[model samples]
Target chain A: MKRIESLTNQWVKETKKLHKKKYRDITNQYILEGEHSVQEALENNGLIDCVITTDDGLLKYKSILSKVSEEQLVVVTDGILKQLSELPTPQEIIAIMKKSEELTGFGEKILVLDHVQDPGNVGTMIRTADAAGFDQVILSEGCVDVYQSKVQRALQGSQFHVSIVTNVALDKWIEQAKMRHILTVATALDDTAMSFKELQLTESIAIIMGNEGQGVSSDVLLHVDKKVYIPMKGQAESLNVAVAAGIVMFHF
Target chain B: MKRIESLTNQWVKETKKLHKKKYRDITNQYILEGEHSVQEALENNGLIDCVITTDDGLLKYKSILSKVSEEQLVVVTDGILKQLSELPTPQEIIAIMKKSEELTGFGEKILVLDHVQDPGNVGTMIRTADAAGFDQVILSEGCVDVYQSKVQRALQGSQFHVSIVTNVALDKWIEQAKMRHILTVATALDDTAMSFKELQLTESIAIIMGNEGQGVSSDVLLHVDKKVYIPMKGQAESLNVAVAAGIVMFHF
Candidate 1:
């Protein structure tokens, strides 16, 4: 196996750059840290560029490491690994993976996020969508990058199970979905909005959840067939964005 | 108003100690940062020991400050306020509040947590319970401290909306709740567990959520009247704890 001992090694320097969104976008690659995430990426046939680990990590994850090709494995010192990691303690293993191809088609159930900012909220919503059997997740232009480490940690490997499409024009997508006879619903509290419980389950549907503070954007709300609200019985003005998405997603 | 200009001032040093759980416990006081949280505590008649802010903060929150008595107000320099804040960018105002008294009576609906360790998860679940009109929340002994800054931020003032009981013994509480004729349901996937959808709504109910890694503790699970599971139709193994709590809370 190849080995890198120096923290200043050219390869180590380049790998560390993957921590930033700009670098990830430029290289079309991101890092997945920890044993579970690395194992999931490997099992899912994620396009892995390489795997980096220490000697201890190699022995600890021997069963998982057996799947990696010798050419794609690199041994590194603990110090080097920590320098490349986003975590404070750093994990035993980290995998460099290429971004998955954009999904072209939509399934029976779809989740659309418009300007949703929190990484944890975005990741949790994606995982919930997967559990709810949603086909695709569409992210509007202003949504947080799903490739960030925080979001990746929150996803817990659901990113591999569901299709995600980013940088979407929500209004255009809604119009296209409507033309295909798919019901598009936005969670909002406008005059025409009705309770989400009143919504009927449809064979093909898309549910749009908005930013944390704001409900669905006005322009996107104008394009959907229905605007629904989750009726809150207590003094809390609204539910957390991720929680609201889960309640709505599981209902159908 | 009293003025504190030095970060090392006796009062400033003492107030800063509230950031630690041990100190918070000793003094029975906690700090609430940011304008929204401080405002919520004030409006809800939270037991305020003092309101600490900079001259700029005082000017910015003039309307809100009008409610605070001169005796309970203190003006501090920007550096002093920063020293007391948890956030990197400290908000203008901070409030020192006494924890609410332990609730003696049970309500119609309750949410019980067993060893839920994540601060964000606990706070979000409490907020969700409030939004669902659940009457109270009981926290197991091993759960994260709700008074922690991270949990307080995630709560967004829901701590003031619902009655919260902390450091609870799950088995004992379950026995007491059962005696009161409340149906206790636990989220788990054991042999006796059934789909949550099959649960019949009762006049009074207590839903127990477990740790992020382990579902409800086996001891607590044995004590509940029913074991329910949220059925997942997709490839994801489980839902995020907070999201799962929201779905179940809203279901009834």
Candidate 2:
């Protein structure tokens, strides 16, 4: 393993920029930090570009060092890891992974998040989608970056479990789904919307969730097969987006 | 109309202590900060004890200004509100609300959160439970404070919508529920739990979720009617705690 002490190292600077979504898109790479996160990355070690960490991090995870090939290991300082991480306390190890080749139509169930701005919500949805065996999570163009550290960390390594594709035109998918007889359920607040429990079964479906402040976009809702809602006796207008996604995913 | 500018003001010093759970418990009052939160307390004026804010906060909420009795309104400086807020940009208004007296009776649908430590999770669960038309939320002895700023913010006024009793002895409630023929369903990972969607739900039920890291405590699990699991498909192993809760809640 070679030490990457030079702050001027082009790769170090480039990887650090991945902390920002703009940089991630430009470079097509994202950084995963923390021992647990790095280990999870290696556990699913199919598409990682390289593993970069401090000597101390290497020592800490030495047992799993054999997991990555020598050519893919890069040693750097803890200070460098801090510079690269979006975490308040930088993790000891960070791995650089190539965004999986954009995946589409991977399986029966897909989730479309509509302009959900919260990083934690996005992450939780991705993690839950993976756990519920959803084939893929398709995000509308304006949603939060899935590769952002907060989201990646929240995914709890589920990021690697499912295919996440973004910048989608949801209406086209909804049209296709309807043809396959998969009902597109858009959650709404109105009484006309049937209770979630009463929804008809669709083996193939796309449940669309909207933004934090607003319900699903009107355009997306218009294309859905049916409008549904989680009935509320309490005054809360709705559930958190992630929670809503979870409930819908599990039941669907 | 009086602006209490000095920290020496009796209300200012007393309000500062509301930041801690100890003081909130001892005083039997909790502070609601931010315009939206303060507005929530005001809208539910039956629960508010008093309010403190700058003139702007008072003026901004003029529509609801008459809701709080004039004496309950105590004007303060921005600095006071800042010191009272966990967030940097403290909202102009802050209110002191009396904690609702715990109600008696095991309702038709109850949610038991065991040792859920994240304020966000507790709050979001309360909101989700309310939206799913749950009867109440019971927090085990170790669950996070439901009155914390983040929880309050997450609930988005659902706190007033549902009955939440914290620090309850789980056994006592289990006994009470059993007498009422209420079933307990504990969410777990490895337990050969039936799918959450498949539960033979009794009219009266308790959906129990556990701590973020550890699933339901062994003691709690022992008492549940059945252990239930949300099916997962992707390679990821887990979903966020709140998401898991929503999944179970929606099923019933």
Candidate 3:
């Protein structure tokens, strides 16, 4: 275990830079803060590079530390942690974790979010995919950077619990997914799409949810085998895309 | 349409007061802005007292305004609109809309949120319920104020599209609901309750979703006829509560 006391410390500066998507991608690492998120990363045995904490960080995460290998622990001052965090109320603990590699052929379910710009929705979808027993959660390049602090917080450490990969070529990813016999069910309001309940999710499937405003891109739709709707019974034009995604994922 | 130009205008001062819950409640009026939200509100022939907008707002929403009564339109200066707005980047238009009455019905589905305080979730849930064709969306007293700007924005005028009532007494509402022969489903992690898919929601039903952290209160649970859960298939323990509700609402 090592200790960092200054915000100017090389590691602290590097950690702060990790907030940028280009930096995260280049380094193959991202920052996730919060006692729960840090603990989940360790407990799930996700790739954890180091742990950062204020004075109280260790106190709050003593249990998590025991679960993680001792060599991975890095303690830093509260000031250092604050400089490295994006949250208004900084968590006592933060973890440097490896970006998840592309995962395939996990199980019966997967999720593909096409250009979901809201980090809150992106993170919530990933978390839902994990809970619904989906094998993986895939993201198109246009979606918010999943490594952003807000997305990580919204995930509540589910980022470590699920298989997630981002910024890939959508058509290539779909091609890889199709090899595993994964059916892609996209959501659209058009008359051609069957109601969600009518779709058979019994086979390995990837449920595609699109942006809040602009819907599924035509390319993604072309890759999908079928289109579905949640069957709106009211005057409102649409459901929040994330909520709609959760509905389909749970049903599948 | 009368125009208000000064930030210090009496109407601007009064409208600014709406940022507080007391003023919003006492007046039974709240602020709504952004082209999309206002258009959604107007296109639906909502209970809007009047609209405040600049020339740009008029241009962006002219199509929607065509559906609104001319008597309810109020043109205002950009300065006045900024003073009335709470968002950093103020939309060109803001509307002072009258709140609807508490809903009482049994023939259609409904959603009751118990003490869920996050404005975004509360708003998203209301909007989601509206899209799902629920008869109404009820907010318990302790939940976030439905008329707040953040909730209003997140709702994206689903507030206008759906029947939303706040400050409700749970027992009475449930009693009125059950009298209509509606199923009341409370979601919990417990296994005995039917998996969300297994439950039938074809008839009148009241599905109660709880707070972000604490689930349906035992008090609310006592009133529900059945408990339901979105089955967990992976390492994650639970999905975000709102996402969970969205999934179940459609599946049922």
Candidate 4:
């Protein structure tokens, strides 16, 4: 077994750099923390660059270690693990998994996000979309980077289960979706917008959710096939974007 | 107008103390910040002890100041304002408002939370409950204090518009709700938990949401009339608590 006790080890330096988005983008891999998320990735055949664990972590996650290649495992000192960790209390196990390549195909159901800036919201939406059985989640250029740590935490390993592609042109995708007979729905509150319940079900569909404060962006709103609003019965002006997406995603 | 320049001044000290739950409970008041939340409290006739603003804030919110009593307004230095503020960038205006007294009567639609500890989730749930036009939100003792700053921000001023009562015994409340013929639904994924869609609609309902990591507590689960789970077609283990709450709340 190889043991790394120094923080200045070449692998340690490289793994620490993975905390930043720039480094993550360049390496095409991101640091995944926590036992559950790491285990999910391993089980789902996610690309694993390597696994890092403390001495105690090796024993604690012995079952996890049994599944991975011994050559790919690196045992580190507790101090070294703390330096590589992002959480206040570092989990015993951490994994570096390659970012999944952007998917070209689409399923019957799709979700498009327009400039939704919050990391937690972006992750929750992906998790929700996956639960609702959406085929893919396409992010517009203005959306937050999905590789952000808060996003990965909020996703709770759902990122491995779902197809999440970033930097897509939403207007162009809406046109493509329409051509494929997928009903594109934008959540808006305009007078012409029908209640979400009033919309007729379709075999193929796409839903567009917008920023926290702003509804769907104007240009993207124009390309959608229909506009629907979740009828608000109380004084709240709008629902949280992720919740709104779940309600709409499940409604169909 | 009375002006406070020193952080040690009686009002400044008291306002700063409001950030902690201990002082907030003893004084029966909590700090409300930003234009939206303060304005919501003003419009809804929330119990406002005093309004604190910087000179620029007073000028900017002149329309808001006109509605309150002159005696209740206090002008403070920007430096002092920053000390009293919780955000990275402090809002110009702040208000000290009394917490709403607990409600004795039950409403048609009630949302009960059992040990949902995340402040953001608790706040978002309250906002969603308001949007769904639920009559009230009852928080179990184990839940995070709703007056926490993060919860307040996530709520987006919905706190003033909704009836939110804390420290309630949920098991007892479920019994009362059942007597009123309000359908009691617990969100669980157990074998006996039917699909949320299978439940019959009722005139009134109370839905209990649980902690993020753990679903509804076992003891509380036994008191609910029915248990329903949101059907998941994809691989994600569970939906976010707030998203799950919105789906169940809107399903009715």
Candidate 5:
């Protein structure tokens, strides 16, 4: 197998750029680190451009490595792996996978995010939405780039399992969803909002989760058919955005 | 106000040591940082052993500082503040608060953790339990200290609002809960476990959440009156521990 020793090499330099959002968007590829994520990508038939592994990783992942094409496998030095990895203690294996194309048509249950910028929250919401059996997750333009490494880690390989569309116009999407006869529910701490426990699930529903500090924006609230709030019995100002999303997603 | 410039001072040394769990336990004190937590502690009538602030903090928090006794206030340099803080950008103010006495006599709804080691998860579970109107949270001996900086941050101001008992003997607590005629529910992914949706709540209940990787421990599960699993419909392995806790807490 060919080995990459020099960090100065064009391939190494390009792969290192995957750590940033701009580079990931430009190349339409993102780095998948750790054994679980790489294995998940392989199992999901992800479009893998290449696999980079340290000497330790080659032995550790010998079983999975056998499935990768000889040309697609490049063993790299620990130094090169460190330079490419986003983690403090870099994992030995990394896979370069093409971004999955966005899906069309909404599932019966949909989750929409409005300027919910934290990468961890974004990733967790996607994972929870998937587990809760939501059809699709659409993020507004102001949300963090879903391809960022922090998000990918929080997603725990569920990103590949779910349908996620980022940089969508949330207002326009909500209008379209309403046109499609989907019930739009806004989650906010407003006087007019009914308790989430009192919410009735329809055949088609789109749930909107808002920013950490701000509840759902007024424009989005205007488009929603109903507004519901999780009853807060304690002094906590608000629930963590991801936790709130999980509660709402699974309510049905 | 007395300004302490020397890090070698006995008070400074003692306060800095509170960052570690051993010192925190020995002194029965932990440093509460940032404006929100300090304010919450003040409002909640927490025992304020001392307050440390940088010049900027003293000026910024002058209104609140007026309420604290002159003897309890110590103005320190920014250097000392940095040394005392865990965040990269340290908060201007830090307060040393005495740990509250543990509560006895269980509330109607109690949440217990068994080896849920992640500080963020522990804190979030506590916050979610509070928001869901649970009466108290009991942490198993193996769980992370609730006073840890990360856990404090995750809890926001809710730490002061909730009754959290750490380092408890969970088995004994479960037995006592059963004796009190409280329904004991274990959250696990066992085949025989009923779906969480089908769970019937009792007037008084204690729900046990488990370790991130390992579900409910066998010993704890053995004592539970019922076992329930969140029904998952997607390819993701499982929901995040805190998310799972939130879903379960809100189910009632």
Candidate 6:
């Protein structure tokens, strides 16, 4: 196993760059911190490039570390781990993972995100989609990066359980979905939109959720098979995007 | 209108202390930042103690500002506003509000949070309860403080729309609720639990959600009229607590 003690070491500097989106995009790799995430990655064939841990972590997480190949394990000081982590109180272990290939084919149940920007919301929606048995999740170009640490943390290993497709044009995706006889529904509150409860369960479907402030984009809405709104019986203007997405995803 | 430019002004320091939970608890007041929240507080009779804004904010929110009486408006410099705010890019306007009295009587529908520690989750669940048309939200002692800046931000002014009671003891609350002929349900996955979809719609009910890592407390779970779980069809072990709460809240 390799040992890294200095923050300025070549490998340490390179791994730290994964914290930035530009670096992650360029390298096609991201970092997952904490014992739970590292363990999840190790168990789930998560394309792990390396596992970094402190001596204390190595001992504390012996069972989980046994799964890591000697070549993929790196020992570091607590200071080094702290320097590599974005969290204020750094976890004992971290994993470097390659971004998984996006599955190309449409599935029976799909979730499309249109410009949903909050990291927690994006991550939570992906987790909810997984829990609701959605086949895949597609993110438009404007959504938060799913590989970002906060998003990864919130995902809690659902990233491995669900197929996530990012940077797709929703309009084109909707058209293709409709061509395949997949019902495409976007959440909106326009005059023509029906209550979500009225939506019929379909064999193949794509449910599109929108930005925190804006509903689905007008361009995307125009291409969808239907638009539905979650009826609000109280004085609240709207539900959180992730919450709304969960309600819709679980309904079907 | 009053103008203050000093960062260390006694009032500025005192108001800034509201960022701490102890100070807020002692003062029975909390701070809300940004235009939408302040506007909602103004329109909803939120017991506004005062509104603080920058000169530019006074001009920018003229329509909303008109609702604030001259005696309740105080103008401060950007630096002073920043000093009092927890946000990195502090909004121009802020409102100090007295905590609303906890409603003593139970209502037709309610949401209860038990030891749910994330501020965002706590706030979003409250918002969902409001959107779901639930009567009130009760937070157990261990939940994150709803008056914290992060929680307030996530609430999106739904705090004004929903009645929220904090520092509740769930077991006792459940007992009292049962006595009042209110059905109490909790999310769990033990042998005795049934699918949440099977939950019969009731005239009066309280739905209890638990911590992020743990389901409802065992003691509290013992007191509920029914134990229910959201049946997961996918491989994911669990759903985000807020998302789970949303799905259950809207189901009724």
Which number leads on DockQ?
A: 4
- Residue B91 lDDT (model 2): 72
| Error in Å for residue B98 of model 1 | 0.9
Which residue window of length 10 is worst by lDDT in model 4 chain B?
A: B99-108
- DockQ per candidate: 0.90, 0.72, 0.76, 0.91, 0.79, 0.87
lDDT score for residue A230 of model 3: 80
| Native-referenced Cα lDDT, model 2 | 0.80
**TM-score per candidate, in order?**
0.98, 0.90, 0.91, 0.97, 0.95, 0.98
**What are the RMSD figures for all models against the true structure?**
1.1, 2.8, 2.6, 1.4, 1.8, 1.1
| Residue A139 Cα positional deviation in candidate 4, in Å, after optimal superposition | 0.7
Evaluate model 5: give its lDDT: 0.87
Q: DockQ rank, highest first?
A: 4, 1, 6, 5, 3, 2
Q: Write the per-residue lDDT of candidate 6 for residues A64-183, one digit (tens) a residue.
A: 999999999999998889988999998888999999899888988999999999998898899899999997999998999999999999898999988899999877888888899999
Better of 3 and 6 by lDDT: 6
Task: Work out candidate 1's RMSD over C-alphas.
Answer: 1.1
Query: lDDT tens string, model 2, A165-238?
Result: 88877778778778877768898876668887788777777788999888799888888878888766667776
- Name model 6 segments beyond 4 Å from true: none
Candidate 6 chain A weakest lDDT stretch, 10 residues: A169-178
lDDT tens per residue, model 3, B106-125: 43678889999998898888
Give residue A95's lDDT in candidate 6 (0 to 100).
92
What's the number of clashes in each of the models? 0, 5, 2, 0, 0, 0
Count of clashes in candidate 2? 5
- Winning candidate number (lDDT): 1
- Predictions ranked by lDDT, top down? 1, 6, 4, 5, 2, 3
Chain A TM-score, candidate 3?
0.91
lDDT tens digits, residues A1-252, model 5? Answer: 679898899989988888888889899999888888888888888889899898999899999888889999999999999999999898898888899888867778889999998998898899999899886888898999998888888888888787888888888888889899999998988788998888887899999999998878999998799999998887788899899999988987
lDDT per residue as tens, model 3, A1-252:
787787688877878899898998899898888878877777777788888775576777677777766687778877777788888878777888887675644446778888999988888888878877787787888889988888988888777666777776778877777787788788987878998778765678888888888889888888778999888877767788778877777775
